[model samples]
Target: MTKEEAKKKWDLTRKMLEITDDEYNGVTQEDANLRFVKMKLQIAVYYMQLLDEHDSEYQVPWNKEQFKWALRKPVGDKKKQQAKEWCHQCRLMRDKTCTNWNYEEVKTA
Candidate 1:
């Protein structure tokens, strides 16, 4: 099955099983299988949030530059250059050292 199909199946199972964050937190480290399942589900949830087609709320954790970098097509030299620039700008923004990182202006520049 495709990853998306598997994720949908897991989500349905989670809903049917009524798995809650509280339950995951209460589980001890000794229960490795439970912990692993919880971890994997949480990651899958985040991945879905990131890949969601409409109204993605997952962009909050990422800056504009990082989000743009993720959205950039991974093809051709032009896109590759834009991706590299976005990555550099994101790092600079995170470091609080970039004084001239205007999104619209930089995109045209």
Candidate 2:
């Protein structure tokens, strides 16, 4: 897929998942817990795209850092809670970006 197609797919996935700005920002920035979720989501998207390709042995474009993140799943209640929060934040961010990429509009008062 082209770059625009991939971006559109990412945006559409975020919207369909109802991701909010807080969640998106959490992973995009310095939130370690949420970053895991972001990586997982991106990884999943990559795999999905791979499945759609006719070449089954095609190599995915993910780097080392992404694989490292995707390899570690959240364990225990506390970590799970953090992961849940991250999912929520990500969903919110996705939703916000689906429309306009406005910072102020995404901020909740």
Candidate 3:
């Protein structure tokens, strides 16, 4: 898909899921990408179910195991690093030592 299409899909999915700005900001980029993939997988599953309902003998061609795996949230080192940095910055701000603090974290936190 084109970048615009992907972005539109992501935005729509985010809205439908009622993902608040604070919740979205807390996650790493990788986590956001995974959520997008999971949303797409869910949409596919819904479409397949509709097809099944229309025709009882219709079978989904995709492997269910792969879908299950794709739906799982990934744990990664980047997320941990981001969290540590965020905590460090928070501590710095709390101590009034940080001159150039990240405003996004504060807004979301």
Best by TM-score: 3
Kindly list the per-residue Cα lDDT of model 2 for residues 9-49, writing each as its tens digit: 55754443343477556653344544545555554554443
Pick the lDDT winner.
2
User: Which 10 consecutive positions of candidate 1 have the poorest summed lDDT?
Assistant: 50-59
- Scored against the true structure, residue 86 in model 3 reaches a CA lDDT of 37
Clashes of 1: 0
Give the Cα RMSD of candidate 1: 16.2
State TM-scores per candidate. 0.25, 0.30, 0.38
Off by over 4 Å in 3: 1-25, 73-109
Q: For each candidate, what is the lDDT?
A: 0.40, 0.44, 0.42
- Ordered list by lDDT, greatest first: 2, 3, 1
Candidate 1's TM-score reads 0.25
In candidate 2, position 60 carries an lDDT of 35
> Model 3: how large is the Cα RMSD against the reference?
18.9
Which 10 consecutive positions of candidate 3 have the poorest summed lDDT? 48-57
